[model samples]
Target: MPAGELFTVPPVRGGTKPEGSSRNKQKEYQLVRVKNTWCRVECRQEMPTTWEEDQVIVSQAKIGEQVTESGVSWVVKAPIYFCYKVIETQNLLNPSNKTLLYGHVSDPEEIDEYQKKTQKRFVVMDATVEQIYGSKVRKYFEAHNVVYKILALETTEETKSMDIVLHILEEVHKFSLDRRTEPIIAIGGGVCLDAVGLAASLYRRRTPYIRVPTTLLSYVDASVGAKNGVNFCNCKNKLGSYTPPIATFLDRSFIQTIPRRHISNGLGEILKMALMKHKGLFQILEKHGKYLLDSKFQSTNVLDCNDDAALKTTRLAIQTMLEELAPNLWEDDLDRLVDYGHVISPELEMNLLPALMHGEAVNIDMAFMTYVSHEIGLITLEERNRIVQCMQNLELPVFHRDCSFQLIKKALAERFKHSGGKLRLSLSTGLGTAEIFNNVSEETMMCAFAAWQEDLGEHST
Candidate 1:
């Protein structure tokens, strides 16, 4: 029999046909005449079979079997490609889907240009004090004729309330939507980005937004991915959403006016990325350690001191880390990648009454985590010492003594609850490999804390 010929008898819809001498499964076989030749063939069960006497039977292999010369054999696994074609049989079918824009911007001037190109409503959330960048941002928007709203966030610890930030975002979003805008835009550091990004997620039930990260921390770590949110009940970043921005713009010009402390803070985040994931970054930092340390202050002379080389190295390192970890950002497998040093740092920041900067706390937390890793035999003592030495070379504190042991224990216990009873922290196994654990004993934590306290005491006294 040949293919595509009419048959005298119509194929049964749900009835069985015989296969040689055995009873065939119902709807498993079809009999047809091809070019006036009659033959029985297996139905393509993977596809919907239509009944027609004029239609010819196509040879399709049976389930769990492959077609062969002698007989059907068990099927071996092979990749299959599926192409779908939607049939517009219904009158109400719609084909147009919503457009989502994702990316980042780094300059204040480029915000208007991006808005014009992407047709997204723009908003700039500034984490710095209003007296510094607020007027400048407003003037930039005005000169470019870009419609935007500037939310000048307060920098005090009391103003860092997650609820307050959320309220501000909600009000801004409502204002934007009262005029029928499509998307939201955020421009600032990690705190501003997280707060605004959360607002964008909640407003209109997940409106798209773009990020223009001005600070180095956001540029290297926070602003690149979709994780956005704010601290809850004094716990750092406790309430939030994993909402990826539509786009990100990396502009180095923003770093020009950044304060020295801000620069060092951002460096702390970069160091965390290097220590936890990329050994090449560690090498780069080691090579240019002095240059980075000297480039802390904002001066034309300081900027010319081979600082561009260090910035380029850090940028490349962060780009590589993002490319390697992009797929896992929204998934559940965040065990090692969560090694941003925020696990313990967040607790300290809350308990120490908020004078400690986020990255400073992270700096101390990374040191403690490294110490714990060494004690647990995950990493050698030398490696742990090297980690502390690197941080010290950068002029970052490896330990802090602002809180007492009782205060530390209380903070960790609270953190344990806030993290959903799982105290799994990202601990280093070596320079690049990090492990997450929920089973770190309280005794181990206290011992490590005590050691760190003693070390600090020796240095201070």
Candidate 2:
């Protein structure tokens, strides 16, 4: 059936009833176009519903819907509303800062009421993070007189599985959380945040959750979005959901404890947004990336929140990410520029799990795709060189020995299969600009691969 508008059924009609409805109260609907468009369901307290289709003039609703002469089917088309903050605050360990408690209150109006209640939270923290800040976190919570359970897990790519999610759920079930107001807090890297999000989404069918990223990678990449999952069947984030958190609290000071390589790993993601849509960001990383890395994103005062390359880099990354994520939160539109480095990275990252960091794998994918873009005449040699040099300057790996042509072909094949039969690969047409190209030929790919290997794979073979 062709897609059209979905109209509400008038009150219990005393008209001719459709066959097979069984009873007067029972409504029937022939399901069509629902997969392609959002269809409104007529819901009443006790009345039945019937559905069919008709081509009519459009409505002000952005998502169109339709119905016709079929059994009544009721569906609540109410949109789920939840806003999360990606805040930048200092001394997350200090009870005086109240950074840990901010996730509990979504709005300022709730602050006074929240302070009056006995607060409690279930926190899922990365083992590494817990090792460094566990005592401090406990002290902060104790000082606030907040009842909290902090569960530490080794949430690494190697351990990103359903088992980990189940383990978290087991703890959450024991905690007897109040699903509505009390949130499951995630404190760690992307893996920790992803696992905790999945667990929170599963528990009680969508309990509220918060993300407090302690690594630069998670701070800039994972904490800004709603996508969460664990690896399954050897695929990265194979089992996942678009369940966003109630808030995502970011603190750059957390990066101080992480290794320098991990800092570089996060920059790989920052560089991604830069290459895709922000030229000034790319230039900043190109010039002052070393400063940001050495200072652990605290080149200026962490509390200042202004006047530094590190500050600009984090904000730019978050803004660019949100600009892409907010409208397409559910990924209703599969063609996304934010997927620039993700096409091959998932397979490549999983194929070499624990060896290559998520951002490293992504940078490698981006690096090769850069050559593909160059071969397709989307960018100049100078532009391609600048991107590669930028990656190298940020201490990111541009190529991998394990990332072979066969692997590339296989990854692309999987991507093509999953992406609605089209590659829909996002490639940089120029610095800070990119486009989704579904028509890049295998010939172009092979030529690009050969050039990419020659330029960066010198130590591979």
The most accurate candidate by lDDT is 2
**Residues forming the 10-long window of minimal summed lDDT in candidate 2:** 56-65
Alpha-carbon RMSD, candidate 2: 7.8
Candidate 2, number of clashes: 19
* Cα RMSD of predicted structure 1: 13.6
lDDT of 1 by residue, 1-461 (tens): 23322121234466425433343222334445565665555556332355454565544332233332334434322222221111111111011211112123335566555556534245656756344555655655454454566566653444555665667666665556432234565667777778778777777677666666677667677776778877667766778888776665554446556776666777778788778777877766666665765664223432343456555554655676576557566645545454557766767777776567777888888887777787777889788878888887766777877655666567667666756677657778898777677787878877777666666544645
Whose TM-score is greatest here? 2
Q: Would you estimate the TM-scores of all the predictions?
A: 0.67, 0.85
Q: How many residue pairs clash in each candidate?
A: 12, 19
Cα-lDDT of candidate 1: 0.61
The TM-score, computed over Cα atoms with residue i paired to residue i, of candidate 1 is 0.67
